[model samples]
Target chain A: MLLNKIIREKINSKLMLTFTILSCLLVVLIFFGLYYKSSPLFTNNSIKDLLFSSEWFPLKGKFGLLPFISSTIWVTLISVIIAIPFSLLTAIYLTEYADKRFVRMINPLIDILAGLPSVIFGIWGVIMIVPFIKNHIAPALGISSGGYCLLAGGIVLAVMILPVIIHVVSEVFRAIPQDLKNASLSLGATQWQTIKYVVIRKSMPGIIAAIVLGLSRAFGETLAVLMVVGNVVKMPHSVFDPAYPLPALIANNYGEMLSIPLYDSALMFSALILFVIVLIFNVISRIILVRIERSLGIG
Target chain B: MDKRKIEESIFKILMRVATLSIVISLAVILISIIYKAIPVMNWGMISQTPQGGFYLGENGGVLNAILGSLYLATGATILALMLSFPIVFYINIYAKKGSWFVHTVRLCFDILWGIPSIVYGAFGFSIMILLGMRTSLFAGIIVIALVILPIIVRALDEVVRMIPQGLLDASYSLGATKTQTSVKIVTRQALPGLITAILIAFGRGIGDAAAVLFTTGYTDNVPTSLFDSAATLPLAIFFQLGSPVEAVQNRAFASALILTIIILSISILARYFSGKYNKFKV
Candidate 1:
């Protein structure tokens, strides 16, 4: 027994030591991966120009990533504009108005929606969604034919993100303690009034977190937007115009990186810029998520 | 009372409309994909390689991509599990206090989780490209493992941490070896959760397209080694959709359905594993 006890203690110590090493190794590797891959494009002078320059012409040796940035922002903005309403309305209905059984049914449906891969969604968009917009939605708005356009991409993105936002917001609403609901009801508040005045107020941080998460995801979304968004590098005149985002630019254009020094560097530079944007967005979302956890005492 | 009841009914109706539409849309999308896919699905699509366009339902299969996905994903899944469990165990067990080491590692995983898959793709691309490997099967395997590591770590961390400390103490007090306690007592307790973690990582790895799109250079031909170019199922769908042939379109739809079914099955199995494990503990 004494020998076994000593053996157990030794094993525990070894396990602890091993785990520590693994964590450090992975973190180091990730940073190394980023810095190592991005070194070619990160020289001090060109870094500034790549980030701040107004125009992006890789073929002419001008490689600013601003167009991809603005294009990403534009499509993301349009998507949030459409998705925010649908998600909020859906959240309110699910939490404040729907019956318990109905809520159960809808929640899993949303989970399944969330699990749907972006590639399948892209296929759906290219085949079914693009044509629908070209023949019906676009012309109805008096726009030129653009089955593949910013509007189509944004809408598909909105649909893809709706479940995530709705899931987060509804969870927030559900997390509000029953006592708060009872108190609101006892004060003679209507269901809507209770939800608005009490429930939403209490869950404000979570709602913000949900919004931030949605924005972060919308900004970072790739295949869905890449497949639908017409790969036009120019600025959009309307939602119907084609757009190319940073993700698409890197994904599609990077492979064609031979025989041109400027073009190859341009792809790497855009990748670096994308890294920065995603990092900032993730930080903001983390802040909001932390606040939600603190406010709800759930962290 | 009557007026209040009427107002309640109106609100209920509004809720019904919004909730029902969302549900209906989800169903419609699933049914639509299945409807498109089932008719075109055949054994040959699984066994054969693409000869021409599979859109009009007349071409070859997704043999290389299918085999590549399974082989690479299986490799990645195994690698991720080997890397994950030890880290998760160390973090949860040894780093209970707000120690600098533990805190930094935890933050690293958090940041890694949100880092875009494209960035991983970029990193993997440079390394692979430099190594004279552009779009090889090994590239897909490594990047997918890295991409899903954060999620697997998080899930496994939670699972391992939940193994009660008493069990550890009890085993030790009874004179068991440390390895015995860890491998036999704690890990046994964490079986269901570990399964959940693995399933989650496997699901993410198999479904990835964008991260691997450039790295796993498109290859219609079957790969004979980790160095060979390969297409995954998601790549198959994307390439097929863009092809001009009607046969390619049909194959794309069928492949999409197959992908959906694969994802759905993984999710279901994951849920069951998690739930059953938790239930068993209770």
Candidate 2:
């Protein structure tokens, strides 16, 4: 009996140790894989040329990533801009002004929205938004092109990102001490005043973190944006122009990457850039959130 | 004071508009999907595999894709559970609360959670190339398991963390080993949330197209082994929509409708279970 018990204990400890280390080990392996695969880009190319050049022809031996870099930045910025106001107001309403019954009904809806597949959004974007833009909005705006452009991509991304920003911001709003709002209200502040002076001030850090996280999501979104964004490898002059972002560039070209000299390396380089940017955004937001939790004495 | 009242009312209107827009957008999405998908969604399209030139408006079905998605998601979710439950159990039972190691591990997971699915695919593609592996069900499973691992761990961690510390103390006072306490008390307390987490991860894994685009390497056949290239509902929709033919495009919507129904049912089931658990607790 004692020998069996000892063996059981040994097995327990071994299992625990192995599982705990597996997470860290997998992360390290992924990082090493990306780093090792991306190393070839540095051999024949200067980092400056990769970042600044607009020409990206593998046949002609020019590997400028300026077009994709600009596309990614522009699309991300536009999507975030479109998403923030609606998300902020919705969050504020749900947490502060809405009735409890209403909040209860909407909360699950938001969760459902968050969990819906991106492909659904992609299909909607292609069938609904693209044609609507091409037939109505584009002509009205005097832009002569198919609607498969940066604008469609941004709008779809905004819809996909809305739930994420709203959820996080609302959570932050919920975390604010109720007594602070009560004090503001009892001091003769209006409802909006209480929100502006008490709730927003306390949760500003968390809200910023939420927006940054949303931006990271928008930056790395693929497939939906891929379906909408016309994969023309050029710098778009306007939101209506077809342009290729980094993720789309990688997804579109990586299948045939080995065919062109340095093609695979350049695509790997793009992936590395995307990975690093997302990491930086996520880390920054996490640090800020940790600080917020520490200050508030919540975890 | 009067000015402030007017501003408050205006702000209220803005907030209502913002919230209503969300409702409206969701309504629009559903309405459009149903209207477009109804015509093409039929019995045969869902039951048979493709024959010749399926992308050219030919008569074929998404049976391979539906079955492949089921196999891929089930495999990945099981793999993720095997990896995540142990880690969660360790952090809760063996390690001290708020330890540096726990903090670092949580931080790493938060970072992983934010990393895009495409990035996971790209990273997985590189590793696959290094191992001289082709795109197959196995590659999809590994990459997708990695992608959903953080979600499962973080969700289950939150659930387990909510189990009162006193429960652990109580179990210890009764002379239970750490393993026993964790396995019995912690698992019991967190079972419902664990189900919810798995549902969420399954939905995520099954719906995701980017992570498996290159890794899974789509095929029209049901995957017979881990090495077989598998078609998925999302990729089927993607390829069908890419076609210039109208009928093929309609089939894309049909495929999407099927996927949406599957995801919606899973979520509803998740909500029902969690709600039931909450009532039982109270």
Candidate 3:
């Protein structure tokens, strides 16, 4: 027993370190994998060469991530722009105006919506929505191929992200102390005005956090966009035009890559860009949350 | 009063329209999916192998996939739990000095939760390719579990943390061994959290399609072993979307509805149990 105890005592630190290293390595490996796959695309000097060279031709050995980066931002902006108002308004109604009973009723329903798997949304978009758009909505919009257009994907994505945005924003709104709401109303601000100015302002960090989370979520979604967004290589012009996003590009080609070096590297490059974007969003959200926590004086 | 009331009425109507549209869409989606998905619910659809292409349809029953998802997720969750519980327990209980490391891990895990499944999928794809199991269920489960470990740890920590420090003080004063106190007393307090954590992971795994898709490509047969390739409900939806036939699309809808229900039920159950625990404690 003494010998066994001694052995455990000696090796315990080793065990702990192993687990810690594994966790840290998982995070590190994601970055390393990106660099390893995308090494062929290095164009110039350290910072400017890696990020700003403005040329991404993996096949031709020119690596330009700017266009893909810009396209992603565009899609994210479009989805968020459509989602924010609806979500904010919904949060307002749920938290500020609705009765507790009514709020309880709506809350779980929205929670369920948030929990709907992305693949299901992909199926719905592909089987029903895209075709519906192509046959009905597209004719009205005057788009060419109704299948993979940006508008269709954006709208589906907006709906997929709606429940998340509303649920998070509502929770943030609900967290605001009741006195704040009462304080606004006491100053002759109407209920709507109170919600708009006081409650909303107090919840801005959380609301922004929610939006950034949504952007991250939208940025990484694969199946929904893959099935609906036409995997066109060229940059997309309008929401009406068809274009591929980063994750979709990775999913479509990763499994069946006949073109060895370039295709695989391109997929990895997009993955790298995505990893960088998500990492930035995460860090920013953490810093903002810490600031909010400090300002609130309670966590 | 007349003109202002008239404008207020218009705004109210507009708000009502917008709210109703959201509600209507929600209902319409459920109804459309359920109605379409009803025909695909036969047991035979699962029991058999992919056979005569339903008019140039993909071959194979999803039997292997169902078993594969179950075992792989189970295995991964078990691995995650074993790794997390002891380490998190030590940090939370004994190694107070290592709080920073623990907290940093917790933070990364939280960041991990916010990450959409595709990044995890890419991570799995990378690891799996190295293991030479490019389209395997083990890869799928590892991705799912990695994505969910933080959730389990957080929930377990919350449950344990809420156990009054008084209990630990009492046990130690009574000369109880730390191991005895942890196994018998500390983890008992955390049982609810552990269950909640498992359910949370299950719920997340059940809903996650992206990570599993790349790691475990769409195989119709449910996997009987951990090492085999297979599909799950999430992947089924993605796979069926590209099918040329309407019947297959309907099957996807039905599968989607089933998947949503499973996710929804677990979430609802978690809420109920957690709420009950709160009330019981109060």
Candidate 4:
């Protein structure tokens, strides 16, 4: 009976360790799997041309990723720009100023927004933002557009990521010791002065980490951006011009991958780019977050 | 002093405006979807599979997509939970405190969680080709399981980490082995959180379209076997909206409404169970 109990315990522990190792191995597997699949495209085209040139002719063997990359940057930039102030302000309000009842009421709304699928956001973008831009905003700016442009993609993405940023930033704010705020207040600092000088200064790293996470999310968003961002393969001169982001390129063209010689490889290469970029962003933010947690003595 | 007072009031108003706008946007999305969906939503929409030329806006239902989503999400959630539970157990119970291995494992999960589902779809497709398998329900499940594995593990890990050290010491003082303690004590303590994590992952898996796009070949009929192609609600909405026909587009709204309802209920259920189980926790 004693031997059987020991053996069972030993087997259970070993089994758990094996599963943990496999979970860690998955990350490495994804990285190399994408690299191996995309390696074929490098044999045909130089890395510079693949990334820099704007020409994307799968039949002619010319695949330039500049247009897609530029569009992604523009859209992500627009989203971060729009989402940062709004999310930060909202987070500050909820954490610092709002009473318990107000916070409680707002929390579920934020949860619902976060829980909504990307596809639903896509449909909303197509229905509301697209027409609103096509008829009002574009014409107001003296630009003619079909409404499916970088701006539309950016606005939709901003809304989608707002809940994410708000959640993180609010948590960061909540982590600030009430003593710190009280110290400033007792020193005759106004409420705004206390937040501006003490809370914001202390949580700067956490805030930046939250924004980076939101940026990473925006980078890889596929369906919603794919829907509103006109899938035109060209360099966009302005937010009103239609452009295709990298994820959109991959999602749109994967079905026809078998038709071209190196098409599958090219699409895989885009996925790799997205993978690498998101990984770097995540790592950077993780380091920042970890440092903050360590300093705060909370994990 | 006067300038500071002005700034304080101005910023306060700005923050309130921002909060109000966000709440308004949420209301807008829910209202618009419900408004558009109400016209076309009916018993047949959820009860029967597509008839002839459903994509062209003919008579039919999204029964195939609904069933497919349920099957795919259910399978993936189960697979992910099997892996995640063990990983979380090992990290919390077996691993050394603040060890580098634990930290590395956590970093890996975080990175995996950050990766977009589209990349997972691409990777899953490549794996399918390499394994000599076709796009089918099995492929979709595997990919989605990968997508949600990190989400489940991280969530459960957070909850398990909160389990008080005294609780574990008490079990050990009673002469229980680590495995036994983990299985009996830790499991019971974290049961509410575990369920919430599982449900949240399920909601995400079912709502995701990109990860399953290339892996699950869509069909109008419900899948009868693991190897059979499956249709999902998100993909159904996508394909239907692509059609130029207005009726097809309306059906897309109906599909979105159904997806939203399922997701919202899961979240509400998660909240309810978590609150209910709070009384049991120390």
- Model 3 TM-score (2 dp): 0.87
Interface RMSD (Å), each candidate?
A: 3.1, 1.3, 3.4, 0.8
The local distance difference test score of each candidate is 0.76, 0.89, 0.69, 0.94
State the TM-score of candidate 1 restricted to chain B: 0.87
Top model by TM-score, which number?
4
| Better candidate by lDDT, 1 or 2 | 2
Give the winner by TM-score: 1 or 4.
4
**Residue range B2-81, candidate 1, lDDT tens digits:** 67667766766765766677777677678778888888889888889877644455668988778777777787888777
Q: Write the per-residue lDDT of candidate 3 for residues A31-111, one digit (tens) a residue.
A: 887778666545332435445555656556555555555556666777788787777777776666568897777777776
Worst 10 residues of 1 chain B by lDDT: B89-98
Per residue, candidate 4 scores C-alpha lDDT tens digits across A1-299 of 87898999889989999999987887789899999999999998999999999999999999999999999999999999999999999999999999999999999899989988999999999889999999999999898999999999999999999998999999889888999999999999999999999999999999999999999999999999999999899899999999899999999988899889999999999999999999999999988888888788887
How does model 3 do on interface RMSD, in angstroms? 3.4
B158-262 in candidate 4: lDDT tens per residue?
999999999999999998999989989999999989989999999999999999999998999999999999999999999998989999999999999999899
lDDT of 2 by residue, A1-299 (tens): 76776688678867886877777676666667787887777777789999999978888767899999999998899899999999999999999889999999888877877888888998999988999889999999887879999999999999889999998899889889889999999999998999998899989999999999999999999888999989898888999998899999998887789998888878888888898899899999999888877777986
Instruction: Give per-residue lDDT, candidate 4, residue B150.
Output: 95
What lDDT does candidate 2 reach at residue A52?
A: 97
Model 4 CA RMSD to the hidden true structure, in angstroms: 1.0
Quote each prediction's TM-score: 0.89, 0.97, 0.87, 0.99
Count backbone overlaps in model 4.
0
- Those runs of model 2 whose alpha carbons end farther than 4 Å from true positions after fitting are A1-11, B280-282
Name the runs in model 3 displaced over 4 angstroms.
Answer: A1-21, A43-68, A142-147, B1-22, B39-41, B58-60, B95-103, B131-134, B176-182, B218-220, B275-282
Can you tell me which runs of candidate 4 are displaced by over 4 Å?
Answer: none
